[model samples]
Structure formats: C-alpha cells, structure tokens
Target: MRLNNSKKAKFFYFLSSLILMTLFLGAAFFVLEQYRFYILGWKSVLLIIIPALLALIFIFSGRQIFEYDSDGEALNFRNRNVLTFFNKPVRDEFPKYKLLQYEFVNILIFKRLYITISSKKNNLIILKYDVSYLTGKELKDLKFSLSKVIKANQEREKNS
Candidate 1:
C-alpha cells in the first residue's frame, strides 16, 4: 500500500515557505540597516547566512513525505540535508518480517502517532500524524497488518 499527500497538503507547505521567507527578509533588512554599526562582527554574518540558506532550501525543495515499499528486502528511508554527511546508503538487513506500527500516544508530549518497527527490540522510526482522523476500522486494519510483520520477524529470528 502507498500513501500520497493530498493537493491541499502540498499547497500548505508552499504557503508556509512564503510566510517564512517574508519574515526572514524583514529581519535581514533590519540587521543590515539598523544594527550594522554595532553588530558588524563575524558572528552576525554567521547567523544570517545559516538561516538565509535554510530558507532558500525550503523554498526550493517542497515538503518530503515518507512512504513504505515492500518490493526490496531492506527498508528505505530517504531525506535531503544541508550537507552530504551520510552519503552511503544503509544496506544492513534488518530482521526479515519487521513491520512498521503506529501507536496513538503522546510522542515526547505531543499528540502524534508514535510510529515504530517492532522486533525483539522496538526500533522507533518517528512520530507521525495523530490518529484522531482515522476511522475505527482503518485503525484496526493497520494494527493487524503491522502485528503480522512483527510475528514473522520473531519466527525468523527463532529459526536462525
């Protein structure tokens, strides 16, 4: 199964970048004009450059969403970064039957679904959206499918 973002969701990301860019440019102008004499230090340049680059990247790169695919043996997680720090792709094989599961819990105090992969030890992927919008049957079906994955992994480990 695949999950794709709706049109509204895509548009919201674009709208957010526009707002942030406006605020960032306003601050940049203030620093360059009003406080240039006092804050002419290297620290000022460092701060401004970092945020400006971040804003530019966000404006250019639309929001990235994660979806799972089961064709290949390994789990794939992809994201872009400011620096190419982790250039090598992760190729280690996790337990064969591990499944991604989500629990509607307070993930670090926020009301988001805590998504994790369950094996002998739980490998947390990340906090996803809340379960408030999901129907009862949808939630049940999702949980059931995920449990099967966990069960398969456990069996594989036992045989090994």
Candidate 2:
C-alpha cells in the first residue's frame, strides 16, 4: 500500500496562506490608521494580534507532509515540511523483518507515528512522523498495514 497526503497538504497550505495574507493586510491597515490618528487603542492592537496568532498556529500545525510506501520488501516513510527551504526532509527505509514495534500518539490537534526498527549492529532506531493531516480512514489503514508487518515479524521470530 502506498499513501500520500498531498491533497490535504495542498489545502492546508492554501488556508494558511489565506490567513497570513489577511493578517498582513489587517496590519497594514492598522498601521495606516495609527499614523493618521496617533492613537494606540487596545482593540486595534488585538485586531492585528489575533489574526497573526491564528496564522502562526495554522502554519505550525500543518507543516509536515507524510508519505508511506510498503510495496516492496522494505517499508518506506517520508516526512517533509511545507516550507522546503527551512528544513531537510526525513526518509526512512527498513526491511519488514527489522520492524520491532510501532506506536501512535495523539496530543490535542497533533498526531504522531513512531516506529522502532533493529539496525544491522543490533541497535534500535526510532523514527517519528507527523500525521496530523491524515484522515481517520487513512490513519486506520496505515495502522492496519503496520500491524500486519509486526505480526509477520513476530511469527517469523517464533519459528526461528
């Protein structure tokens, strides 16, 4: 199974851009008014601050784009931010037999996936991915796929 949240990421970017543009325009208007009246009022400050805060929240929450692929013998995962210039993308690939455990964590509006795998040197490596924008169905599917792999690994271990 291969899954990517390109659509959701695009929509999120669009909404964030809209909010940011609104914040900038509102700030500009406030600045113009302030220049004319020389009056600093609480309401005006809030009018600018509220939208700016909202924009920041939206940008931070929707930064990551998640992708999962499990077609071959190895499982592949990619996590990249919407702002490509800021940070490097994270990519992980390990054979199915290397998977040790998987976990999902939900904190308020954020959702994360954690996977532990065994390295060639017999060390454990943990990888984390942001899955906040994935729909309920998509999340369920991903969980099911990972669970199948873990089960297979357990059975193989028992036989060995």
Candidate 3:
C-alpha cells in the first residue's frame, strides 16, 4: 500500500527539452541537406553525433536517478544495482521527522551530509547522487515546509 498520495509530479524541464530536441533535429536535418559533404567529415560527425545520442537518451528517459520516500520506514534508499560513484550517500544526514510533503528540491536532514533529489512518486523518476538537481522554486517550497516542521518540533520540546 502506498502511503503518500500520488499527484502529478511537475517536471518543468520537459517542454523545454522537447523544444530543444525538436530544434536540434530540424537543424541536423537542415545541415545534412545543406552542408551534407561538410558534416560527413570526422570533426562534424563527432560534434553532432555525440550530443544527438545524448539528447535522444534524455528525451526518451528524462533525467532522474532516485526516488523519495518521506513516509517509509527507511528514510533513504540507494539502488543496489547502481554502481556507487559518490563514495557517500546523497543526503547530508539521515532524515529525522515524519516527512509530510516533498516536491522536486534539495533536501538536507540535519543528521546526514549528502544532497538528494526529492522523489515525487514511484514511476516518474528517481535521481541519485545528483548534486545539480532541484530548482530555486522547489528549494523555497521545501525550506518553508521544513521550517514549519522544525518550529513544531521546538514547540513540542518546550512544552515537554
């Protein structure tokens, strides 16, 4: 049974990437037709082929490597099949507190010391060991929620 309610996870970059890929494909075709002889050379092939292959990968899969589980018994997860490259878990510390809500953002639990991409749901995408994930807006939303949770914790502490 799923604990967190599923909602449409916003991947803001999807449209931009689609547009970019479309443009690149158009340009590549145009180049092939207009400058066909020039593009056949090694240098042109290297410049266009590598990025095109990468773009195709991105277009098909999207960019994500981890999933977020705020309510799970285990607060963090690393895929066993994935080769460990960072030499450290993404979060700065093991997340403490019941995670109420999370959007695409950078999460810093006080105890842990590695950065992590906040997961939205099961199948969308999960980013792992990714330092460059999260946007400014997502970060702001997360900070606001975290501040509220911290304040509530402080109040409970004082009362007890």
Candidate 4:
C-alpha cells in the first residue's frame, strides 16, 4: 500500500518552497545584475548560484519514491534527490522468522503508524522504514495485509 502525508502537509511544503524559490531566485537575479559591482569577484557567482540551486533542489526533493511488491513480500523506497545518486535504495523483504512490532507516533501535527521488525539479527529495525503517510482506512488495510503475509511466512519457516 502506497501511503502519503495528508493534504495539509503537502500544502505546507508547497507554500514554504514557493516562498524560498521566490526569495532565492529574486536575490540571484539582483546579484547577477550587479556583476561589475562585486568586490568578491568569483565569490559572488558562488553566492548567487548556491541559494538559487538549493531552492530548485528543495522543490524537486519533495518528490518521494515508493515501491511495494505485488504480493506484499517486499518494499523499497527513497527520497528523490541528488543524494539518491549516492544512497542505496531502502529495501525490506518481509522476513519469516522476525517478529514485527508497531506503534502510533505523534510528531508535531502528524500521527503515524510506525512499524519495526525484531529478530536474532543485531539490526534494530531490519527494514529501512520510511514514514509512509496513510489514512485511517489505509492503515487498517496495511495492518491486515501485513498480518496475513507474516503469518504465511512464519508457517513456511516452521515447515522448513
């Protein structure tokens, strides 16, 4: 199940990004116009370029990547950004023997269903759990779906 933050969260992101974009781009334009007035010479180019580029990147990085297996056997996700070029994608294969744990986390104005897996392994949470935003119904459905798959995996593990 692909979940996303509420509309309010998205709107907040948009408004903030829009303001930053306007401010940075406007300043960049003003600085570029004052090319000859620069005492710092090449340093002026870096100053104008950095914030303008950051603003553009800020807008782009808001995009999220989500991928779940058809059978709910695995999930992978990541943020769409320049860092993604270096960062490996987060992937979790619903492990058979590991016990799953979950809770409701309240961060600022948001409520989220947080889940983690426990096992003999040293990893605290075997899956790189990105906070996927889900509505009440979606959360319920995810819980149900996970329970089913986990049970099936456990049975298979037991048989083996």
Candidate 5:
C-alpha cells in the first residue's frame, strides 16, 4: 500500500494562503484608516489583533505532508513541511521484521503516529509523524497496514 496526502496538502495551502492574505489586507486597511482618521482606539487594535491571532493559530496547527509506502519487504515513510526552508524533510525505511509497534494519537487539531522499531544494534527506536492532514479513510488504511505488519512480525517471532 502506498499513500500520500498531496491533495489535502494542496487544500491546506490554499486555505492558509487565504487566511494570511486576509490578515495582511486587514492590517493594511487598519493602518490606512488610522492615518486618515487619526484614531488609535482599542476597537481598531482589536479588529487587527483578532484576525492576526486566528491566522497564527491556523498556520501553527498545520502539519507536514506525509507519505507512506509499504512495498517489497520494507516500509518507507516520509514527512516534508509545506515551508521547506523551516526544516529538512524526514525519511525512514525499515524491513517489516523490524517493526515492533505502531500507535495513533488524536488530540484536538493534532494527530500523530508513533512507531517503534528495532535497530540493527538491538535497540528500540521510536519515530513520530504528523498525520493531521490525513482523511479518516486514509488513517484507517494506515492503521490496518501497520497492524498487519505488526501481527506478521509477532507470528514470525513466535515461530522462531
């Protein structure tokens, strides 16, 4: 199974752009009005501050685009932010047998995936991914795929 949330990411970018534009335009208009009327009241400040805060919340709540590929004997995962300059993209790949456990977490606007895997040095490594942009169906599919791999790994371990 291969899954990527490119469509959702595009929509997110569009919405964020609209909000940011609105914020900028509001601030510009407020400044112009203040200059014309010489008014420095709380109401005018509130008008600008509210939208700025909302835009900040909307943008900060946003998550990176996530991609998953479970082909051949390895599972590959990738996470890249919309603003590429902020941080480097994360990529991970490991064989099925190395998978130990997987979990999903949902808290308000934040959704995340946690995966535990065995390293070559026999140490356990935990990885986290933002899944806020994934749809319900996509999340379900991801859970099913990870569960299948975990089950298979458990069976193989028992047999061994």
Candidate 6:
C-alpha cells in the first residue's frame, strides 16, 4: 500500500507558504520604496538573496509530497521533493526477511512508530506531523501486512 500527504496537510502547507510569500514581497517593497535600497553591496545582496531563497523553500515544500510504500516483501519511502527538478530520488528500502519487529513508541516524550529493519541498523521511523493523525492507523495496517508476509515466507521455506 501507498500513503501520501493528506489534503488537509497540503492545504496547511499551501496556506503557510502563501502567507510567507506575501510577507517577503511586502518586506521587499518596504525596503525598496521606503529606504530606497538597491542590491549593490553585500548587505543589500544578502537582503534580496536570503528572502528569495526562503520563499523558494517555502514554495517547494508546499508543493512537496511525502510518500510511503510497502509491499509484502519490502518497504520504500521518500519525499517527492516537487520543486527540485532533475533530482534523483534517494529511495530507502527495507526487505522483509531482515525486519526484526516494530512498536509504537515515545522517546523524550515525542510520539512516533519505529520498525526495526535490522539489529545492526537504526529503526525506520514513521515521520510525525502535528496536522495529521492518519499515520497511526496506516502504520498499524502496514505492520499487519508485513507480519503476514513474514509468516508466508516462513511457510514456503518449511515446505521446500
């Protein structure tokens, strides 16, 4: 199964970026008109460059999709960094046979789920979002599916 960012999450992201863009444009206008600033020096260049980069980041993130994919045998996850053109995806994959276990957990009072892919490696964490509660249900469903995969694999091995 695949899980993508929810509509409400995307709406919040879009709205937040829209507000930030408006603020940056407003600041640029104020600096140019009220103070008669020009992008001629390092300081002026910084003012223009920094806000522009920040605006771009906000816009890019707003357009981004956080996706999670899992099958019986392997799990893959990555962010579709939408504005990053020509960027190759760095997909993280964990095979079922190596999976140890999983649990809903908290550390330092932060709530999240962790799936142990291997004892030698760090657990794959379900990323948290304050605006979304759907992840909890999804992760549990994924865990259920993965368990079935492991059991089936074991049965096939025994019958062989």
lDDT of each: 0.47, 0.83, 0.40, 0.51, 0.83, 0.54
The TM-score ranking, best first, is 2, 5, 6, 4, 1, 3
Model 4 error, position 112 (Å): 5.6
Model 2 steric clash total: 0
**Candidate 6 whole-model C-alpha lDDT, 0 to 1:** 0.54
For the record, the alpha-carbon RMSD of candidate 5 to the native fold, in angstroms, is 2.2
Q: Is candidate 4 or candidate 5 better by TM-score?
A: 5
Give a tens-digit lDDT track for model 2, residues 1-160: 9989876667766776788788998898788767776566656676688888886676556446889999989999998877676467888887999999999998877788989999999999998888887889999999999999999999999999
Candidate achieving the largest TM-score = 2
For candidate 5, report its TM-score.
0.86
lDDT of 5: 0.83
Candidate 4 stretches with Cα past 4 Å from truth are: 1-20, 26-63, 70-88, 109-113, 120-128, 132-137, 149-160
TM-score winner between candidates 2 and 6 = 2
Off by over 4 Å in 2: 37-40
Deviation of model 3 at 155, angstroms: 2.2
lDDT per residue, candidate 4, 1-160, as tens digits?
Answer: 5543434455545655675776677576657656646566656566566666665544433333333432444543332222344345454555434545556554543344455667566576633333334446755765676676567667876899
Give one digit per residue, the lDDT tens place, for model 3 in 40-148. Answer: 4545545456666555544333223333343433455332112233233344224434333333333342111133323445223333333123344544444564456
Which pairs of residues have clashing backbones in candidate 6? Answer: none
Q: At residue 102, give the lDDT of candidate 6.
A: 54
lDDT of 1 by residue, 1-160 (tens): 3222232445545655665676587567657855665554555565456666666644444223323333356543322222233232222234335545546653332233455655565645453443332345645554565566667666877999
List, residue by residue over 14-105, the lDDT tens digit for candidate 6: 65567567668756865785467554544555555666666654543322444567655676656443335524444567665665555555
lDDT, candidate 1, at 158? 90
For every candidate, C-alpha RMSD to the true structure in Å = 8.9, 2.0, 11.0, 7.9, 2.2, 8.0
Deviation from truth (RMSD, Å), model 1: 8.9
Identify the runs in model 1 with alpha carbons over 4 angstroms from their true place.
Answer: 4-9, 25-64, 79-105, 108-145, 157-160
